[model samples]
Target: MWVQRVIELTGWEPLGVSVDWAVVEGELGVPLPADYKELYEAFGGGVFSDSVYFLGRDEGVSFDFLAQWRVGLSVDQDGKFGDVSAVDPYAIYAPGGKGLVEWTPPNGPTSTSG
Candidate 1:
């Protein structure tokens, strides 16, 4: 939760969070700069960008400035949780920037991953 708080205090908003932050791809996670945490909920973000199905570059994110689709995620300091499932544009205010999530009707929980 400390990680999430640090992100929010810095003014970044969380997009969504996966069940497990540890499960995020290593390559994609490794390249994130130190400031990445500052933009995460740990700083001040309210969104949850930790979902396994996050909608950003798989290789990495533009740490310098947030892209139109980039977002963050975090559990509150009290242990409460939040996600971006119902949020618009994930975190950005652009159109069609949420990418293409292939929903599989009402039967499968696993939607097609791009």
Candidate 2:
């Protein structure tokens, strides 16, 4: 429903892409949110309204979700991004721990995490 709303608002046709969730979750060391997975499946990777860039399963691309997540963690750990107060200091969400995870590209107004 939410994805449909996004489609309606953005006039984006769903790509209906398939992703290897097992591989993605395995690499991330945690299961991704169902809604996120659904969104990915519906839309894949691309920018929305030139503002929000949704990372997807595409490897080595600017919109690759997994690569962005790794880069986010690396940048946070290296203290390179600067002023990442929006995200937790160095925590990443896991089985019992709470932390932030990247779902969008970094820099500009396009990046986002949760």
Candidate 3:
């Protein structure tokens, strides 16, 4: 609803392609929010107001956002501390970690771990 409102106001256009959730979730090891997938489906990827840059599933681009996120995970998992790890890197998601830790589902809410 809010996203649709923003789109209506800003004239943001969709990328016009269906997303592959299976591949995405399999690679990320998490289930994402439905609204986020809807937004991604409506708007492929790009920056907004020169402040927020949206990540898309475009694999051809060198600056793929999803690819970048994976890189961060790799760095953390490898324990190569560039200047202190921003994220645990080795931190496991809920059901494996401490308790119900919140996780960012790309552009969605921090889903409560079950």
Query: In TM-score terms, which candidate is top?
Result: 3
Candidate 2: segments with Cα more than 4 A from true spot? 8-12, 78-114
Arranged by TM-score, best first = 3, 2, 1
Q: Which lDDT values do the candidates have, in the order given?
A: 0.37, 0.73, 0.65
Candidate 3 overall Cα lDDT vs. reference? 0.65
Candidate 1 on 1-114: residue-level lDDT in tens? 555665467665654422222333242333333344333423323335664332332234532123323333322122343333424444534466755443332444433334
Model 2 clash tally, residue pairs: 0
RMSD of each: 15.5, 10.2, 8.0
| Clashing residue pairs in candidate 2 (N, C-alpha, C atoms within 3 angstroms) | none
Instruction: Report the lDDT tens digits of candidate 2 across residue range 24-93.
Output: 8787656676778888888788887997888778855688878887777666663555454437555766
Model 3 lDDT at residue 35: 70
Q: Candidate 1: misplaced stretches above 4 Å? A: 1-22, 25-29, 43-114
**Worst window of 10 by summed lDDT in candidate 2:** 103-112
Candidate 3 per-residue lDDT, tens place, 9-39, comes to 8787755667787777776666767776777
If both were scored by lDDT, which would come out higher, candidate 2 or candidate 3? 2
RMSD of 3: 8.0
TM-score of each: 0.19, 0.56, 0.57
The residue-level lDDT of candidate 2 at 55 comes to 79
Query: Which is the better candidate, 1 or 2, if ranked by lDDT?
Result: 2
Winner on TM-score between 2 and 3 is 3
